[model samples]
Target: MGLLFLTIFLTDFFGYTDALLRFDRVRRKVWMFVGTRSPIELDWDRLTPVSQGITPANSNVNTFRSVLLVDLDAEGDVKFDGKYPRIASIGQTSLNEQQAISQYEYVRQFMELGPTHLPSCETYLEHRTVFRDIVRFFGFLDLARNIDWRRPGETGGGLLVLASILCMLLGWAFLPFDLATYIAYRCNRVPKWPAKIEAYAKDGGEMTTPVGAASGRMRIVLKEVPFILLWVGCAFAVYAWVASWFIK
Candidate 1:
């Protein structure tokens, strides 16, 4: 148990800490280039266009007029058109129509030309790589599950099993055991937080999952309970073994 606790403390603190640092580095890199904090959103944008394209393929007719004539309402969804008009106008705009046509043509050209400069391309590629790294990191879980466990001896097996158990136990102790479920509940109930706490004041205090509940529990059990129990067990075992020598 002494060995088990030591192993878990080292692995959880060092190994997991290293993994989290790498994850954060990739996350930061993705955010720095993509201009978004979310890695998942960044990944999605790479695979899917923010706005639909007005191509000859998607359009009914080959001519611009025919495509534009199809429907203004059908125009691709603008994600950040309001926020970044310059980027948005690159795809929107037309020569013939002043307001409507110009914007459409601008958008069309922007999509067709893509990013013009090398710096833009490099920035886009860097963000893409960061997104890919996030995906690959998540993929490692699958790889871990497939790894063979039988190769390790009894001591190794015990250590691995205990570490796995401790992680789960500690995680639950630190975080809300039902955190995922609580989040799901909140999502279904409120969907969004009220702009002001007063809005929900009429209804009892806003519900929050027992935050840090898991971490607190983990600290007590992993750092205190198990540490003491394991050390005491080791000491008792050592004393028992030595006592047998005297009796014999």
Candidate 2:
């Protein structure tokens, strides 16, 4: 069962990489690169944006998604200059309508008004290193980066702060799962853009610079080490107790 799940997980992860949509804000165009097919190009303005709520049958669970569709025929097939894919779906699904709209708006703003008009966000590029993977796997870096010992009362009082700490630290109980996630991420293939797309990306735009760890964050991470170790030990103890029943 575990091997079956691993296969499914890898398939789902890599299968999505077979195709990709590339947006060129400077050229005001959208490019679709499907499996072994020639690249399809379309004017950004001609595309229709749709935001929808999706729900599976007999389930209350619903998700919101956004897609950019273009040049549809009577049968709802996509065509570009009469030679392209029959249909294509662009953009990712979100948890809510607002989130779905936000995803669309993010692309729209960039394509319509350039990258300068887009919302600002912190960006980082992590090299594929074992140390980086391990820290990220256990969320040690995030916990370290976001921790503010001096301003514990910023969000709420001491009780609320304590509750947040407990909740975040609870993730440590899933050490095995985190390890599996780390391994998958390390082994996952990183997508490389086509030479044409790469050149286009560098044509003319204000690129976002990747930032590194903030000053003194390593010190903060040191403080969190003991807590993570304690939780890991506890998790192992519980695991050993549970396995003893079947082991012998």
Candidate 3:
């Protein structure tokens, strides 16, 4: 069952559907599609002098080091072209960036939005990202493995030590790290994309509720609460384990 769950989780983690940025030459419209639904549509005229740029990935993959996009405006303002401003990559990730870059070149070659310039974002990536969570989990497991189980007099006592280490790491290190990085990301991305839109743009937000924003927030809570609760359980385990040891 554990293996089955890991298998399923891995599938979902790595799985991607068809995401396309399509241009309707006849209609002069750009449609951004995820699977069958067109999430965003922009008239070709809405974007101009398409600009190509790479910014540190604030919300997406981390390995790429940067998220590349095509900007329609000279300033590459997200507020101005809030529509489908970003072009789709041929594949995904840095390799995708190469393909996306080529695609950008291809689009700019014929469509002629305007002058082309390479732009970079001036902010840090988000902290509560899936990638970060995965990293954190594996990091803790690694830490757990390296723990000196014999140091605290017993293997069980070492569990308490492990828990304290993790709790301290979460409370002291990760908390501040998340805050600082998020602040930087927000400050840099405000002009590019508003806080409100940014909040709703991810899996964190849900569209099913009458209050779409509220639903999205709930989704984040649901995804996040488990991690929190897991840590809390570990903390309790640590306390109980230590207390039992002392009692004896």
Best by TM-score: 2
Let me know the TM-score candidate 1 reaches against the reference structure. Answer: 0.17
In angstroms, give how far residue 248 of model 3 lies from its true place. 36
Q: Rate the local accuracy (lDDT) of all candidates.
A: 0.31, 0.59, 0.44
Best by lDDT: 2
**Model 1, position 211: C-alpha lDDT score:** 29
Q: Name the lDDT of candidate 1.
A: 0.31
Runs with alpha carbons beyond 4 Å of true place in candidate 2: 1-7, 13-19, 35-38, 74-76, 80-91, 125-145, 152-173, 210-220
**TM, every model:** 0.17, 0.72, 0.27
lDDT of 3 by residue, 18-73 (tens): 23454544456555554333346566666543324444658444334223343354
Clashes in model 2: which pairs?
78-86
How do all the candidates rank in terms of TM-score, highest first? 2, 3, 1
Off by over 4 Å in 1: 1-73, 84-205, 210-217, 220-248
**Per-residue CA lDDT of candidate 2, range 37-66, in tens?**
566777776676655567768778765565
